[model samples]
Target: MLTLICQGSSFALHKMATGLRKGAKLNYKLMNEQGISLDTKDNSDNNDDQVAEDTRKDSVFSPVKSKAQKSNASSAEDDGKHSLPEEVDSDDQEIEKLQRELETLEKDEAKLKKIKQKEELRQKVVRKRDEVKALRDVRRVCIMGDSIIKHLPSIQGVSIFAFPGATIGKLSFLVDSRAVPLADFNFVIIHVGTNNIANGHSLQHMSSDFANLVASIRKFNKDIAIIVSSILPRPVDHSHTKSTVQQFNFHSQDYLASELNFKFIRSYRPFCFRGDIKRFLFAKRDGGLHLNSEGSNRLRFFFLRVISTLT
Candidate 1:
């Protein structure tokens, strides 16, 4: 009874092994098509066990099973006859699709980065251009007067053009360029008619001269405000001077107003009325009829008030 049981158990083990071999062969064939390899394997013990099992299966169901397994393996090996496993083929197709999608995504990411960098550079250039333009459009302070403005300290943003021996007749020629330049000015501080007075020019002539200057300025800058400056204090030394400069300040102001509507910066308030003529108005070295540092301060405030009102 023990010998019979041993034979039956060996036959049963051989049958199980044959089925395993057939399944393993099918798996290996599928793996081969997918380029999967287990070539580095050492199956010496399994091969010995399979040989013993095959010998025992000869007395069992070996003949029938071997014939069936051979037919199945032959059919599986023939590419024209049998199809690849559905699960394996599906996995390969999914992997290929995912790989293509990943590549496309990578290319799109690179393209977006390039576009973003280019946009940033364009904005930087535009900002730089605006900064340069702003710097060039600086404020220009235009001075329209006699030699007084020319000799004053270099005020910020200030430019000067004063006719030394100019009267109303020469004014058009004297300020042909500066009239337009000053017309487009941030501030036009004018102090003329002094030369007209010193040279014994008539009040009527002075008025005409002032009117011409205003007319020329208005031609260029229509909105430019005109400041009709009254004659500054003439010292006692120039008392023997030709024209009635003091009378001109009082009467010519009304004359200038009638000719045109403009503001008048009267100097009689600070320098001539309350202060010394020679000490306060003219520099001792200047000798000519011109304003000193103290006198310039009065003119400065007049322009300042003009600026404040406009702003």
Candidate 2:
């Protein structure tokens, strides 16, 4: 009986040991097959990224490159850049790609530079036109207002129909009867009413006076084209904070289209900051609100732009 019991115990222990061995082998197979590892970095086609970087480099180099391209090409060759590794070699094919990129950048830069140069040239032509034009047989342009344009110096062809302290109601030397043939002028620019606002002229009174001025000019020059440059922008300084000037401009702009020849020209975009003189329109010679040579040139260019559009 004792021997049989011991034999049973031995068999049970052996069975348990065999099961543990099988379990260890299964764990090893799973770990080996799955190969617990990670690929953390992304590897994608880098061609697009590299090409964009190359294009940017070309633009920066192309500015001075236009004059230097031939020299650089030769230098690059002598420096053995042509012998770079296959990955970055300046081989015939790669050199051709760089050349094409450089040309594209140079062309784009040239176009922008040309536009700026053209704007400057346009100013020169307009002034020449204004001078040559003043000497021509064109009708006179009589401006009536305060000092805004008082310093324009008498244009050769046109008579000085205005003076300092001229108000909305009456210009110092300007007579209503004289303005009858006004519409016959080649062009006209008017700026008035800052004084009126300061003088306590009500909106209604100012509007009425402006209407009279327009009517008088149209009556005189029946076929004259009106180029109404808005009131020169005023500075944002407290002394210039009056909104009535803007109100006057707004009202005039609204009424300007009523006449066939009346065309409102915004004079400040090129020289003034937006429409506010305080921010940008400092080109006036006085170093105040008015325009100086730069401002005059800007205006001259503006006229050309309009003429180009109309003709």
Candidate 3:
């Protein structure tokens, strides 16, 4: 009985050992199928974590990439901020250059205009000088005035240019227009200012007009003998007119005193008897504004005597 019991115990121990080995094998197979090995799972988990970390780093607003991109963006922004003003400054400099060029052009144009005007005036002066030098006749006389000198008898060498209601201004225009015809005469008698005195022109203005008229005549013929006839006396009742005429004549005589070949004749004195006008010397038909036949004859003789002296 003791031998049998020992054999059974050994068999039992052997079966138990076989069962433990089978259980270990089953566990190994389950581990292989379910992928539950520690080393392999740990390695796979590490790789997945690294991949997730890489994905998070590459995300749209990730801080790591955001910082680096922001740094790059900030550098670009700084460059733009610095360059913007430079572009604007360059544009402004270009505009300023254009403006300076335009101003220079305008100034040049103005200078050219002024130079052209000066040249034109110089040419006009030369032309007038040439016209004066071209005149040949010394005996031909021109008697130009208002209506007062219109009725003078025709003389051999005298040409009459009578303008009714003509003032000093009108005579200036007439002289300029008739410059060609007047160039023939060397003796010019200006019988004007009677109408100016009658029209009550200021003494200062009349004096200036007379000077301008004589200057105009001299421009046409510088060597011509110019005679400015005095304003004739009017009626005794016309006291203001007579006084103005006397003042005008006195001023003209003084003004023409230094002028070469210029004569201011006091023709009014011949018709005035001691500051009173001789009524017979003036036309009774026209309120003594004009001279009658006898007065005209006497004025012709007086002018003839002056002409003879010039010849």
Best by TM-score: 1
TM-score, one value per model? 0.58, 0.43, 0.54
lDDT agreement of model 1 with the native: 0.68
129 Cα displacement, candidate 2 (Å): 25
Candidate 3 lDDT over 1-311, as tens digits, reads 99999999999999999999999889988998998774778899999999998789878767766467779999999999999999999999999999999999999999999999999999999998887665553478889998888888877778888898999877988887863366777788888887888788999888778778877887887878788888787773367786788777887888654553478777766687877777897898888878888888878888887778876
lDDT of 2: 0.61
Q: What residue runs in model 1 are displaced by over 4 Å at the alpha carbon?
A: 1-65, 79-140, 178-180, 240-243, 274-280, 286-288
TM-score of 3: 0.54
The better candidate by lDDT, 2 or 3, is 3
Local distance difference test scores for all models: 0.68, 0.61, 0.82
Residue 144 alpha-carbon offset, candidate 2, angstroms: 5.0
**Strongest candidate by lDDT:** 3
Q: Model 3's lDDT to the true fold? A: 0.82
TM-score of 1: 0.58
Clash counts for the predictions, in order: 0, 14, 0
Per-residue error for 284 in candidate 2, Å, reads: 9.4
Off by over 4 Å in 3: 1-138, 259-261
